[model samples]
Target: MNEALTLISFGENGWGDEIAKGVIVTVTLALATLPFGLILGFIIALAKKSQEPSLRMAANIYTTIFRGLPELLTLFLVYFGVQIGLQQLLKLMGFDVYIEVNSFVAGMVALALVFSSYASEAFLSAFRGIPQGQYEGGYALGLSHAKTMRLIVLPQLIRLALPALGNLWLILLKETSLVSVIGLSDLVRQSGIAARVTKEPFLFFGIACLIYLVLAIISSSGLSSIERWSKRGDATR
Candidate 1:
């Protein structure tokens, strides 16, 4: 209908612009969370592999706690808890300046925590999958520790981890929707607004669903390419 078209039309009279912006925000947040989560997860994996029992125990506890908590609950706790704690600390210091936590920052931190928890397990498994003979061979070749890791260990580890990491990326993309719950103007939030204003929930929500499907398809295609590339060395052998 012309009416439905108009509701999604570009310009001040419609929500097309808002929806576009929301899509961008959602993508940006997911991308931002990716590196931080991977780095933290890498650290946790190493910690668990460490000889120090204390370090291993600490890493285990961290993984258990974050992995056990629901993502939404973690978001709420990080967002509101940090905000309240910061305000209280500022009051105690007599600064009196009001500080508000940015929803984007909170979302990034919370999601990163959740992402790392899951990713660490994948990384740890990849680490363990490397054969002991590889390390011995590297040392026999007179390679230093760093060089051995870079030359012999990393490539195989990445190949092993890529599939799981790609899957996690897909999950993270969907999880970005949860950020909308905390007032981030992500795609779902924008669509909800449009639906409420236009009184056409089905139209707007259906549009949102299609958009997400397109994104997932695109992501899956890219992941497939990466997986193929990772396996190229094996394929040749």
Candidate 2:
């Protein structure tokens, strides 16, 4: 017990600071990618429901390929592939500088890919859940489809997607640990370093677990609140 207490202490050898930093990095990376991912997801969901066959096919292929691929593989493709592609573009312009993609960017991109896959599905379901007659009524009232979606369908869709998106956010936090594999010193990686230095695998790994559990609880509570709010307005309907 004393050893366990000493291991987590905030003195010169403790991992309290490192773990805190890790949590920050993880959360920041998740937030950084969420807006972009959500936009991409909504667009893909639009495509999936598109009137055009070509557009629907494109969306189907994209979602299938991305969802089928292993996340680590996708991470490699995004980080290294994007870096290489950018470098080639620079090279074509006769620029000689090396382009570096940091772990934070890589992690965000990877997690965003996952986020978009699930978010697209959620949005698609939300889109279908809207009554067909609502669209017809809007059209009868001379409202454009775009306007109808914007004013009527979308508000409810946002409410419906909120809970699923919240759950996705929790997964996003956990998946940030994968960034450590790409050489990011996120929470898991930081704990790993301390474990190596102290030769105490159990201590560091256990601390990582505790951090994960605490984060999970906090995230779950947040999602529950959001879910309640989203459902609150539905009580009478």
Candidate 3:
């Protein structure tokens, strides 16, 4: 216990401060991106299910394009390509704006794009699994389609997608490491910094792993609570 506490001490030489800051940034990134990705995923999923062939094809293309590419390539494309694209657009507008995309923003956008692609599949499948009779019943009760989706479909979809979402959260966490390639000072990046400074990969990397484990455990427990709450009404069944 003493040894462990000593390891976590906030001395000038210790990595405690860096690890804490990294964890905060990582959690912030994850939480901020998760909701946005879910919204985008739902939209894409709805698009995929639409009767319009064009809309459905567009969504299908978006999912396939994102999901098929390597995450590393996706990060690079978003990071540099978006910047270049912005610059070109600005040039066309006769504005000399030196647009520098924020690392946090770029990382979130890249991760969200990938997350939404995968999440759309899970969410769409969940929505499909819901009995058609439920929607009919909802219509019979005078609920608007939007109201039925909001009050009925979404709840069930979220409950059903919780497990996949949890797994995606973990994947997102690991993928954050790749953002280090784009110069985001995430956990892995910070750990590399520490290693360079301390010349002790063992200590810094070990601490980083522990931090990731803690974050995963905390996320999993929170998701478990969400799962429980979502299913509370069906406990009797």
Candidate 4:
């Protein structure tokens, strides 16, 4: 018991600080990516539902390419490929600037792209599920397109998309583990380091598993609350 306690202690000898910092990084990456992902997803969903054939086709291609690629490959493309491309562009422009894409930024861009692709389908479905009458009625009532969307359509769209978005959020949380491959020092990487140094593979890996499970549980609880809140107004109607 003492040995296990010592392993998780916060002092210089323990890996507690490193593990805690890793958890923070993992959470930060997810949070930072989420809003941008959702916004891009909303735009893609709108594009897919647009009257223009070209817009629909473009959105389709965007979703198909990102969703079909492996998440790790996307990360590699963003981290290594993008950095190389940027440096080359700078050289071509006669600027001697060497641009470095940090792991956090790369992870954010890659994951956000993936999330937007997947979430676009959910948003498209929600948008289509909304009745055409609502659009007509809003216009009939002198509501501008922007005001109609904000006051009427947005609520229903969010309500319809909540469950799918919650599932996506859970998936996104787990997928953050992949960022460790690009040297983000996230939870899995920190655990691997501790295990390697202490030669306690099972112990450290087990701790990592427990940490992930705890995070999942907490996220699930929060999502459940959001889902319930989202439905409350509709339930009364």
Q: Give the number of colliding residue pairs in candidate 4.
A: 0
- When 3 and 4 are scored with TM-score, the better candidate is 4
lDDT of candidate 2 over 196-229, digit per residue (tens): 9889988888878988899899888988887777
**Predictions ranked by lDDT, top down?**
1, 4, 3, 2
TM-score of 2: 0.91
lDDT of each: 0.93, 0.85, 0.86, 0.92
Candidate 3: C-alpha lDDT? 0.86
Worst 10 residues of 1 by lDDT: 228-237
List, residue by residue over 53-153, the lDDT tens digit for candidate 4. Answer: 99999999999999999999999999999989999998999988878899999999999999999999999989989999999999999999999999999
Q: In every candidate, how many clashes are there? A: 0, 0, 0, 0
Error of 1 at 67 (Å): 0.8
Ordered by TM-score, highest first, the candidates read 4, 1, 3, 2
Model 4: lDDT equals 0.92
Report the lDDT of model 3 for residue 201.
80
Candidate 3: clashing pairs of residues: none
Candidate 1 runs further than 4 Å off: none
lDDT of 3 by residue, 141-160 (tens): 99999999888888998888
Model 3 misplacement above 4 A:
1-8, 235-237
Scored by lDDT, model 2 comes in at: 0.85
